[model samples]
Target: MSAAPEQAVAGRLSFLDRYLAVWILAAMALGLGLGRVVPGLGDALAEVTVTGVSLPIALGLLVMMYPVLAKVRYDRLDTVTRDRRLLLPSLLLNWIVGPALMFALAWLFLPDLPEYRTGLIIVGLARCIAMVIIWNDLACGDREAAAVLVALNSVFQVVAFSALGWFYLSVLPGWLGLEQSGEMGSHLLEQSRELGGVSVWEIARSVLIFLGIPLTAGYLTRRIGEKAKGRAWYESELIPRIGPFALYGLLFTIVILFALQGDAITSQPLDVARIALPLLVYFALMWAGSMALGRSVGLNYSRATTLAFTAAGNNFELAIAVAIATFGATSGQALAGVVGPLIEVPVLIGLVYVALYARRYFTTPAPLTEEDPAHA
Candidate 1:
C-alpha cells in the first residue's frame, strides 16, 4: 500500500483517530468520577497484587505498553539515524523547547493553582512513546524518522525527566517569583515535591518491564514467526494481526484508568478543561514550530510531519506512573498527568488529518534515501 492509504487505514482503525481528543477527556471525567464516588475503589484496585507489585494502575500501564513496544521494528533504527536534521529537531523540541514552554505556561497561568501547575509540567516534560508512531504513520510521516525520534525521546526522558521536574518546581518558580506571583510559592513547592521525586530506578524498572521485555519479545516473536511461516506469512498475515493488539490494549487500559479515577473527575468537572488548554496550545505550537524548522532545513513533508508529531505528543503512561508515585493519587499533579491522554489522543487525530491535507504544500520529492546511522 502507498503511505497515504496505509496511514488512512491506520487512522480508520485507531481509537485515537476516531474520537480525536474527546476520548481522553471522557476518560479523565470517567476516572475522576470513579475515584470520588467510590473512594475505596482506587485503594482496592491498588492492593491487587501482580508478581509482588500490588498496583492495578501500574499493571494496566504495563499491558498497554506491550503492544506499543511490540510494534517497533528494530531493523528500521538505522534508517532513523540517517536523518540527522529530523532527529536533532525532534530532540530539541521535546527536551528543550517543549519542556521550557510548558514550565513557563504553568508558571504564568497556574502559579496559584499548585496541583494544576505541577500536573501541567509533569505532562509537558514527558516525551512521546507509542502514540507518536501511530500519529506519524497516520499522517503519512516518514516512518524511519518517527521510529528514530521515539527511540531518542525514550532515552532522553530517562536522564532529563528528573532534572526538568526539579528545575521547574524548585529553581524556576523562585527565579520567577512564582511565589508572590501566584497562590504563594509554598503550594507550588508542595506540589512540585509531589511531581519531582528522583526515582530513576523505579522508572527504569517500569520501562524495562513494560517496554524492554515486550520489545525483546516482539522482535523474537517476529523472527520466529517469519522463520516458521515463511515470507508470505510474515508479510500477508502476521504483522497485521499483531499490530492491532496494541490499539486494543491501549483502549482497555484507557477504560480501566477512567474507571479508577471516575469520581474525582466528576467533582472537578472543569479541571479537565483547565489542564487541557496549555496542552492544546503546546501541541499547536510544537507542531507548527517543527514544521517551520523542518522547512527551514529543507525537509520533505513526510519528514517534517514525523518531526512535528513526535515533538507534539507526550508519554502519558510514564508521566502518570511518575506522578502517582511522587504526588500520591489525590494530588493535582497526578490528576494533571491523568488528564493528558484525554487531551492528546483526539487532538493528534485531528492533526493527522490536517497533516494529510497539508502534505501537498510541502511535496518536494527528495532522493529516496537510506536510513540513519545512529538508528543503526
Candidate 2:
C-alpha cells in the first residue's frame, strides 16, 4: 500500500538534508566563536562526563542515530544474502579494498603527521553504517540492499574495527618502516586518562552505549509504530517528523566539539585540508570503483548505485567516537574525525548529482511482476 521505502525516499530532499552544509558551517563558526570568546563554557561542558565519555556527545549520538536506524526495514535484510553477486563484492570493497586503499593513501599522503594519519586510518576502518542510506536513497539506489548493507556493516564494524585498527595503528606502520606514535601503543581498549586504566568493559560499554541502545530503540520504535498505526500512516506521518531531529542533534554535537577544540582546529588550519585530501581521494575512488564493479557484475542502476554509495561513505559518528575515545577529544586525531562530517555532506551531495547523471548509462532491472511472462 505504502510505496516501498525506496520510492518514498525519492519524493524530495528535506530542507535539513538539502542545506546541511550551511548548518554544519554555521555550527563550526559558532563553535569557533565560542571557543575563542567564551572558553569557560566549553571547559565546563568538558568536565561533565560519564565514564570518561563526554555526556553531550553520547546523548547527541543517540539522538542523531535513532531516526536513521528506525527507518531501516531489518526484515528485508535477508534479500541481500540471496543476492551474493552484489553482497560478496560489496563486502570485499567495504572491508578489504576500502580499508587497504585508505591506509595506503593516508601513509602516501601524510607520512609526516602520524596523528592525522592515524585519524584517517580510523576513518577507513569505521566504514559506513548510518549515512550511506541517505546517500543511497538520494542516488536513487536500491534501498533494500543499502539497508542490509548498513546493518551488516554495523555488526561488522563493531566486531572488526578494533582489531583492524590495532593492526593498522600499531602493526602496519612498523611493517611499512614508518615511525609509529609512542602514545598509540598496544592499548586497544584503555581510553580514559584520569581513570588510571580503563578495562575491556569500557570499550564494550562505549560501543553498547553509542550503538546498541539506539539500534534497539530504533528497531522497537519501528516495529511498534507499524503494528499500532497502519503502514501508510507510519511511513508518511511518523518518519517525516522524526527524521529532521537527527540533523539537529548532529548540528549541536558539532558546535560542542568545535567549541571545545576550536583552538586545535584554528592553530592547524592546514590539518583540515591535509585530512580532507586523502578522504577526498578515498571517497572519489571508492564511488567510481564501486559503480564500475556493479556494472561489471551486471547489476542494474538501482543496485549499482546502492553498492557505490555504501562503499563510498564512512560512519563518521563511530569514527568520531573512537577518535575521541582513543585520542582525547581535542587531540589532532579527533579533529580529523570532526572534519569528516563537514566534508561528507557537500561531497556526497555533489556525488549524488554525479550518480544521477551516471544513471542514464545503466539499465533498470525489470520489476518482479514484469519479469513473468504471464504479467507481461
Candidate 3:
C-alpha cells in the first residue's frame, strides 16, 4: 500500500483489466440493446443447453474459471487447510451469517413483497461457487485459499441449501412470532414447499456441471502443461496467452445473461430497483464485514480479500434455476432471482477496486515462499 507498491500493482494490470468496468458496462448496455432489439435471442440461447445448463453461459464460466484455477499452486493447498483461522471463519460467514443476514434484510427492506423477500432469502442460502474466483483473482487474492474455500462451500451448499431454505422461508419466521403476521406467515408453508421442491440431486447436478468441469479441466491443464513443457515455459509462455480469455468469457456471459432478461430488466425498472436495493446492502455489508473479520483474525491482504469475496458472493445460477423451477419464469420470485446478478456483477467489480485501495492498510505482506500459492 505504500506509493511504490501501489504504483507497481497498478502497472501490473493489463489494458483489459485496467478498463474492466468500462468493458463490463458496455457489455451490459449491448446485451440490453440486443435483447430489446433482437428477435428470438432468448429462445435461441436457451435451445443450446447441456443437461439443462445454458451452453453460452457455461462456456463463459468454464473459460473464466480455468485460467484462475490453473494459476493456483495446488501442491501448497495443505498450508491453507491447516490454517484454521481462514477455514473456520469462511464456514461461519458463508453458512451461518450470510443467510441469517439476508433473511433480516429481506424482511426489513421488503416487508410487504413476500415473493421478493423469499427470493432474496433463497439467494442468501446459495453460496458462491463460480464467479468468486474471478473477483478474488482480480483483487490479487490468494488463489489456493479461494479454491479450497469455494470447494468447501460447494459441498456444504449441496447438503444445506434446501434445509436452510425451509428454515428461513418457513420455520425461522414462525419461531420469531412472524407466523401470525397475516399473508406472509400464512403462505410460508406453501412457499416453503414450492422452494423445497427443488431436489438435492438437482442442486448437486448444478454444482457438478458448473464447478466440477472447470475444476477438473484446470487441474489437468496445469499437470499437462507443466509436463509437456517445463514449469517455466508453462508459466511464462502459455499462461499469458490464455489469461485474457477470462475477461472475454466474462463479457460474453454478461451480454448473453442480460440479453436473456433484457426486456424484463428494462421494462420493469421500479421492480428491478426494489430487488436491487437489498442485494446492494447485502453485498456491501458482507464483503466489508468479512474483510474486517479476516484482518482481525490475522490473515494477510491476499487471504483476507479472498475471504471477503467468497463470503459475499452468491451462486446466482443456482438461485435463478431454483426460483424458476419453484415459482415459474414469469413470477416475481424469478424476476428477483434474475436481478441478483444484474446488481451483483457491477457491485462486486467496484468492490474489487475498493479492496485494492484498502490493501494499503494491511502494511505487511503475507509471506509467499516457493511453496506458497501465487496470485492468480
If scored against the real structure, what TM-score would every candidate get?
Answer: 0.80, 0.77, 0.94
| Most accurate candidate by lDDT | 3
Candidate 2 segments whose C-alpha is farther than 4 A from its true place: 1-21, 179-207, 320-331, 365-376
Model 2 Cα lDDT, one tens digit per residue, 185-221: 4342233221222234654565577667877898898
The candidate maximizing TM-score is: 3
Residue 145, model 2: lDDT of 84
lDDT, residue 47, candidate 3: 77
Candidate 3 global TM-score: 0.94
**Count: clashes, candidate 3:** 0
**Candidate 2 accuracy as lDDT:** 0.72
Which digits, one per residue and each the tens of the lDDT, describe model 3 over residues 102-169?
99999889988888888898899989999999999887889899999999999998999988888888
Cα deviation of 63 in candidate 1 (Å)?
A: 5.6
